[model samples]
Target chain A: MGVSVLQPGLATTVQDVGRPGYYNVGIPPSGSLDQYSSLAANLLVGNAEDAAVLECTYMGPELRFGSPATVAVTGADLPPLLGGEPRPAWESFAVGAGEVLSFDYLRSGARAYVAVSGGFDVPAVLGSRSTYALGSLGGLEGRALVAGDELPIGDAGGAAPGRSVPEALRSTHPRHREIRVMMGLYDHRLTDGGRRTFAEATWRLTTLADRTGMRYRGATLEFRERVAPFGAGSDPSNIVDAPYPIGSIQVPGGVEPIVLHRDAVSGGGYVMVATVISADMDDVAQSAPNNTTRFVEVDLRPGRRARRRRAARLEALREALA
Target chain B: MSGAGGPGAERAPTVAIRSPLPGVFYRRPSPDFDPFVEVGSPVEPDTTGALFELMKQFFEVPAGTTGTIAAVAVADAEMVDAGQVLFTVRGS
Candidate 1:
């Protein structure tokens, strides 16, 4: 009838595709970090592409099923264990009543999504189950799961046991990844060397990653010498606060670029040198600390094309499972 | 896991301590502190052998199985991936 929390793991939360159309109102779209993987988990479980699922961080949860259930684990390479037996990722499986489900250590990627039959049965905030912890909005009270909490299970209707996603279509997270970005907005503020280093040098993801934003370490960026503009701060990287687009990369103090994610502030007063394209953002979320990432700049056409390719793959995934 | 390298009450002859996440593995608690466990050191299932750091947070690498430190697979402050064995313990 429900999943009882034996151990809540590192950080597990209920999330969906996210609450769109409200960024203008200062509400960050706090959804799954890896959207494609989230969708696949949901699809395998016979839920909608955007159905709510649990996003587990470095460690995973220990749960006992109160009743028969269908489940799927996707995203990170954290393999699921049922009654101490290994279960494959990216596939649907069955759990008998009273069976315990846990996970192994993460092998690749940073987040893992768990999709249950029917879904989380959590109430949606603003038409979505995503959690925005900063605002304390949505998804099981808008925070990470804790021990002793019981989660209601949705009515089961997802794929049968042994149904799995195609390997080619399944996304994999590598230790080193070249993420696509679009430069602009404040590239003029950077000195020529700064721009070159940003484009040429590799950056390492820092543990400063969460739902709000992720930080990276690398060569320091230099800004063009300029007097502080009205409403702008004295730091060369400071500017009149502006709305921050999701995936915008802001470097403060000329070092450690921060990429805003699904649960970031709506606006900020920092100079944004680049924006990670929509299609590749999932990869950015999956990047673990110590993982090297190079921001590969791309044109608008390529960005849009990447989005289309993702949509096509998802459509094919639905068919594959069906 | 109840058997075959799983962590449980029954101890295996040798226990493998692995990093659960990718990060820098620190043998000592701090630069000034002594290493958590050295070779031949007795340890319990819950005993921590090392610290794995990532994103500025520290996670303890527990023995998970009771034994004595048999070998250190990684050096102090070495970067390791998840599932990478960090140390081995010989059980009673």
Candidate 2:
């Protein structure tokens, strides 16, 4: 099957799971920010969990199908239409040859995923089909979709049998406010008051938020004072460089918390005080501007257990549907 | 007045290293360690002298020039604005 972009919205790119094992070379694993929704859309269309799909951001693209095919939409609830008729998301549907599929401005979530019966036939780069825009690698010329861009699809014989996503597996749309996080690698650098403010105060998402990271405006966090000795004399000093990970919260100059995302740099010298759990990453990714977020601490062992349970549940649901 | 130029000559513009984003600024690599670069030390482009952490992501700001560290404009653990001067490097 063949698909062509008519109106390329805000930022649309092909993405799958991601390219891991390249962090040591300063290359981040660029993949779907919301893996849950991406996988759901793929599975609904009978595609493998890692099949490449279109990741639409904020706005979505207008597409035309050159041949009959099965497709599904998931994530962010962007109202998707097939040939001028509204279609439900999270379920597979067949499209006639020469049909036009379009998505309107997102009414909810910041991102949406579209999957075809046979995944998008884009050549993979370094073991991934996802786009990393900054480095100008992967996807369609390493950038967002543009008008007139034709996307090839693998031969899938035709539309597969209809499939339904389990109600329990279907994600309830996340709230824009209140993100959960666990204390991170550099939590010790924060002063007692700094720690209290982080847990107690609510932060407002700023317009500066993006795929790189989310910036917040709220209470300023402080670090314990230190002494810097130059030659012989010691001058008062505070602030240190440290490692970071996805969901790390760093308070530079003790002000404004920035939450790193999928495209965040691999390393830097900054105090990373906390990391948002993986379960909560989807919620953070979908948060719109001006949303309020609060940090919550959880123990590692319990957190790991919760993650395992969630994974098992998702796998079971996928197997039943398959 | 001290130069050999004619009267009413304009003074040279003061050069400064600006902050890339608004956040807390630090000079040292860690609490228990010495800073990567200090006053009078030479720095080259791509030199990772310091970093700024926002939320939890740390962004490294390159020196972008080969020069002697002239002065430290922002203090350790001081809040800074994007594009605000953080250091003054005299080109070598």
Candidate 3:
């Protein structure tokens, strides 16, 4: 089957789970910022959890299918339409040959995932189909989908019947703007007042937010002039160089928190004070500009358990649909 | 000098450089650009010797020591570990 792009959204690219085991080479595991949503979309169409899907940021793309296929839309609800009629999200649906698929303005969430059976037929780069725009690799020509681009869709045989996401899983989709963070690698470097201000103050998302990192504009966190302390195993540091992970929060000059995301760099000089827990990263990804965010710290043991529980529930939901 | 935390009681001065965050290390700014600094180059405390570009943002590594560059440990366009040595400088 084939799919043609009529209008590519603000930035739409194919993404999977991400490329791993290359962080030391400075290549981030660029993939879906919201893995939960991406997996859900794929599972809706009976595709593997890591299948490539169309990731639409803010605005979405317009496309036409060449052959009948089963597809699903997950992540932030973008209010998609199939052939001029409204299409519901978080469930599987069928599209016939020569049908047009369009999306309107985002109703909620910063991005949405579109998964088709057999997945998007895109070349994988470094073991992933996710696009890393800076390196200019992966996805459609290693960049965002453009108008007039034709994408081949693999045929995963015939379509399975449609399925719905469980009510419990659906309820967990984050609508609030609050983002939970573990106190960062440099949490101690900041004065008591600085730490309190960070926890208490409400910061608005600046236009600086993007796939690489989210920059907040609000109270500036200050630190003692001496070199800030470094933390162990993926924690932040004052040393001008270090490896970075998705959800790593870096504070430079003791002010303004930058939350790294899917496309974030491998290392740098800022003090990473906290890391957003995995379970809540989707909430951070779907945050729109101007949304207010507050950071809260949680211990790692409990945080890991929460992530496992969420993952198990999502898997159970996918199995139910199957 | 003899007071609490005074000069006479102070520990020896040792320069320590650490990784700012985790990312890939590029010695030069881009593929075509020359490296920012080299061995024996005079560096101030704030001079950026190299850069680590994560995602798309570029974070510069400041010369933490005011001296002549002594050794270049990491190769150009290499992956560096957090707290790994990139260079050494001998204080003037």
Candidate 2 Cα misplacement greater than 4 A, ranges: A156-161, A176-178, A228-242, B1-92
- On residues A33-56, what C-alpha lDDT tens digit does candidate 3 reach at each position? 888888888888888777899988
What digit string (tens of lDDT, one per residue) describes model 1 on residues A30-108? 8899988998898887887767899998779999999887899999889899999999898889999999999988889
Pick by lDDT: which candidate is best?
1
What would the per-residue lDDT of candidate 2 be over residues A1-322, giving only the tens digit for each residue? 5899999866789899988888777777888888888888888888877788998876678999988889898887787899989988888899888999997546666678999888887889999998888888788888889999999997652347478787777766544466667786767767899889988888877656667788888888867666542331231112343446877876666778888888788766567788888877877877654456788778887678768876886787679666
Please tell me what DockQ candidate 2 reaches. 0.02
Task: List the DockQ of the predictions in order.
Answer: 0.47, 0.02, 0.01
C-alpha lDDT of residue A322 in model 2: 69
Return whichever of 2 and 3 wins on TM-score. Answer: 3
Question: Between the candidate structures 2 and 3, which one is better when assessed by lDDT?
Answer: 3
Q: How accurate is candidate 2 locally (lDDT)?
A: 0.75
Which DockQ value does candidate 3 get? 0.01
Give all candidate RMSDs, comma-separated.
4.4, 15.1, 19.3
Ranking by lDDT, best first?
1, 3, 2
Question: Once superposed on the true structure, which residue ranges of model 3 sit more than 4 Å away at CA?
Answer: A171-175, A227-238, B1-92
Query: Using DockQ as the measure, which candidate wins?
Result: 1
- Tell me the TM-score of model 3: 0.73
